[model samples]
Target: MTQPAKRTKKDKIGSGLKQQSWILLAIVLLAALIDYIWYDAHWVIAKSAALGACLSYLSQAIFAGFVFWHTGYRARRHIVRQMYRGQMVKWLLTVFGFALIFITIQPLSAPALFIGFMVMQISHSWMLWRIG
Candidate 1:
């Protein structure tokens, strides 16, 4: 009888990371598309685009937090490690900081706000390429 092939740990990790990167990429693309359409239709003002950009930034920050948590746990097998805690705190701070910036600048530069969102999406795509 022939035996089924077995997957190695590296293969499993690679596949998982690939799937995660793809999902993240998809989210970024969808958010960008929504922002673009809204802006083109004048459904939202520049300030609103800035607000949306802030939301996208916060979303990415949250995703990074989750990634750190999982990667730390998998690498060290300790959820309470200092690195994990530090990353969590950083993630929270990043989200808050970007949100504050968005609110403060949205009313001043709505088009710039939309540009910020596009930059973030591009950055995410670059990161995914590096990681995946």
Candidate 2:
């Protein structure tokens, strides 16, 4: 009888990471919806919204980390290089960019933020599917 091939550690880790990414994506979308629909639009609620945004970004970072790690790529080194090279500057610019838009446009920020969360969730889900 022929022996079965052994699965690599990378494959195991990738599967685990994929599962985690999906769960995080679901949580992010659900949280965003709940905050939008039922939460009071007060300072405390805004704090909670910010917390959710940070969590969503953190999950995206983790998903990226897992993708790089499983593929034998230097994830943190690449992120650092990109940050120093230009991405961080652009990211900072966008922070103020969105703030300005939020202030001047007024009505667009809520939907825009929710859409951003959805985009992140979809991207994470896609990455997970790729790894799986």
Whole-model lDDT values for every prediction: 0.53, 0.51
Q: What's the CA error at residue 119 for candidate 2, in Å?
A: 21
Q: Which runs in model 2 stand beyond 4 Å of their true positions?
A: 1-8, 40-132
Backbone clash count for every predicted candidate, in the order shown: 1, 0
How far in Å is the alpha carbon of 98 misplaced in model 2? 22
Compared with the true structure, what per-residue lDDT tens digits does model 2 show for residues 34-83? 65677653233333334334445554454444334422233557645644
lDDT of residue 3 for candidate 1: 84
Cα lDDT, model 1, residue 69? 54
**Can you give the lDDT of residue 1 in candidate 1?**
100
* Alpha carbon lDDT at 6, candidate 1: 43
TM-score of 1: 0.33
TM-score per candidate, chains pooled: 0.33, 0.29
